[model samples]
Target: MHIAYFPELALLFADIRFPQDQSPNNASIHLTWRPPHGEAKELDVPLLPDTTSLERIEVTMHSSPTSAYKMGETHNKWLSTCLGYDTVLAYLGENERPVLMSTHQKSNQPQIQQGGGWLSSITSKLPTSLGTIISGDTEPDDKITFADCAPFLVVNEASLHDVSRRLPESEEMDISKFRPNIIVSGAESCWEEDYWSELQTSSGVKLHLVQNCVRCVSLNIDYATGKPGEGESGKVLKKLQSDRRVDKGSKYSPVFGRYAFLGKGDEGKSLAVGDEVTITKRNAERTTFDWPGISSTPLPTAS
Candidate 1:
């Protein structure tokens, strides 16, 4: 609920901080913007979930003023891991307020209906909290496939905890090990593995729960704090693989994550905190998990 709209959304500045170099004046990550829809217009936003600069984007939708700033997956990850945040979904009523539902807080909160094009409206029912309007098509309800096309509903922090419980203390959370765009709050909750399967927010945003996000060694690096990981991110990831959700060994399952194609209408809606998001069930199964490999895919491939 609370569908607030803005025209010409834009990102003014971006920066990232890491524990490796926690200096207050350290030059955090930054990005260069060309204009409203410059040559970079065709370029995809960096989908990487961890990098600070990659986490933020400047969005301007349909001449709305007060340009909306979209936070990439990293911001979501921090919220769950560092903060205890959860949400539900619903559509905006005539008054532009979210309706309520009796659903438990799931891993992928405020699931946005995903698919096609960048300047579109995502009307999902979300637990009253935060929301953002994004560009892209919400994958059709019947067309399910695992590709980068699905919107990400990641659980970075829970994944870390899942890993920590299994692995020895020596292996802790390192950003390089599990780089996720969104991290949910709370412990003992298999946010990524179980909850994501069928969860949504109040804003009528649809989230296609694809699969458990797999991890790469990049999480081993301490990006925020800026120090060679003492091997924390890896430890949590390994533990999850061994004990938590996504048990590949039992059935030879390839590790995969979920994706939701954004929905239609309200192209380029502005999402902000304290909005309603909604998630609905789709009869479609996701496509195969085919995200470009970590090493092979770079920021240049976001579009």
Candidate 2:
């Protein structure tokens, strides 16, 4: 589950970054945390050593239920103290979870199964134009991290600007509230991304637009105070409800951005900042967002 489940997490500022000079496989990544009312601290969590044993735990996501490896007690204790609860940090070790097929995927498309060692052999036979063949040890095209729905959530800067324009004079919307993985600019108009079916970056990485991401109450949380906002700030979701409830699949929650997954041949590729994104495919009509797990039931209306 996302930290949004515990609204207090909004107040926790964590700076997690990878070392620029080292390959990700060998980089020493660290997390610096600034709690609402405490000394800023750094969490030194090393990669799971081969000798360290991890407990397999089950975690439920919006799209499906999957398993993950629970981290050690020290890290869990630190996070639990920050959140004022007993919290366990779960790590999605490689191959621990498979990306579940979504309704947005075409029925006729080939379904990538988990632990399919066949991908390595198939990838080697493909033309080099498709990109380097990824080894089976690395994440397969069908695998995902602990993402809520899709591997990526893409938002248009123009659409965010439009939302800011609609806010009260004293209140401006921030991209952090939406929690998008990619922020795209250069759109001809606001919400133009709704019609985009596929996008390719200048670097050749491609993403297939899936469902429209549904808005949740977490958007109203004030990151500064770690509590629900006041006045107009708290009503961002309500404001969007007027015109953003366009996705019939998730009727109560307004849609803001598009959920996406990496295109088949673009896996194991890196997308740098400022990469020019081009729409490679367009939907003739706006996609009707559908996810039976969450959309099939009614959601609580945002206050």
Candidate 3:
């Protein structure tokens, strides 16, 4: 319903792996804050301090910011970012600065060509008759925190179970692809970006609603189980497009808005949970709302 907090530090990490053989004991993910509602920090470390105890650090997701627009699989998975548990433990102790890593794979992570890079190649696959493809604008400062991004928003236990049953036989739910930042309870029909657009933090940072996020087939891939197949999440979105809302051609309709950037965060620049928000209809003002499946022309705005 509201913006929670502005990220003091954002970290982008790649090539993450956790051994399935053991339960996380020394190092794990946890949210910690000072007493009486103090600073919030995610610790990937252990509580007890010992010579071999693990330390914690926050990670900034790379795919969402860099390659999400293009649907490149090379760096899409979380495993691409996180390292072995023991290695993460060692890194925390050694460095206090924000960290970013690319898995040692010889192959390059698939990159999205915004304006100049991969746009032409991606559009080449789509039928030329489909019209022009417009690249959505990117706002650098409008980054979200890990707390805001969670998969539960798109699917939960009950929804997952029902989805599995309703899905065609042999079909699996690749629920991880949506990669929701906030798993909200009782959200309205509007896209999350529309909601985010109307949001303002206590710090007076106006959340800028830049563009409606167009999703790709990646949602068809499951993050946790790493299963590949079309299932619940994609089915639901496809259904939403076909039966009730926009036609299939409206995939890039900007159902959700992207945060363009954040304002200043001073001592008073703090965003908390449960703040007031005003809703602004999405694409409502546009004379023509069309989804350019894929096109070579650069988007109207660059910033």
Estimated TM-score for each candidate: 0.39, 0.80, 0.35
| Candidate 2 Cα deviation (angstroms), residue 285 | 1.8
Among all candidates shown, the one with the greatest lDDT: 2
Task: Give the lowest summed-lDDT range of ten residues in model 1.
Answer: 93-102
- Please say which candidate is ahead in lDDT: 1 or 3: 1
Quantify all predictions' global Cα lDDT against the true fold: 0.33, 0.66, 0.28
Model 2, span 1-303: residue lDDT tens? 464567777655544344676344544436555666778666766544232588888887764567777888988998887777898977766533454435255544333222211111010111223222222222223555566666567888889888998888876798888887688877778887776777777776766776788888888888877788888888888889989888777788888988776666565676666667777666655666655557755433559
Question: Candidate 3 at 104: error in angstroms?
Answer: 38
Candidate 2 pairs with clashing backbones: none
Ranking by lDDT: 2, 1, 3
The global Cα lDDT (0 to 1) of model 2 is 0.66
Candidate 2 vs candidate 3: the TM-score winner is 2
Q: In model 2, which range of ten residues has the least summed lDDT?
A: 116-125
Residue 4 in model 1: shift from native, Å?
Answer: 38
TM-score of 3: 0.35
How well is each residue in 1-303 modelled by candidate 1, as lDDT tens digits?
Answer: 111111111212233443466543343444322333333222122222234333233322221112223344444343233222431111111111111111122344444343332222223222222233234443322221121233344342454454455546665443323323334343233343343443343444444454444443333434433233454452433434443334332222324234333444434444433333332342232223322332122223345
RMSD of 2: 8.9
Q: Which stretches of candidate 1 lie over 4 Å from their true place?
A: 1-134, 138-153, 156-160, 164-188, 191-199, 224-228, 231-234, 244-257, 274-279, 282-303
Q: Give me the displacement of residue 199 in model 2, in angstroms.
A: 0.9
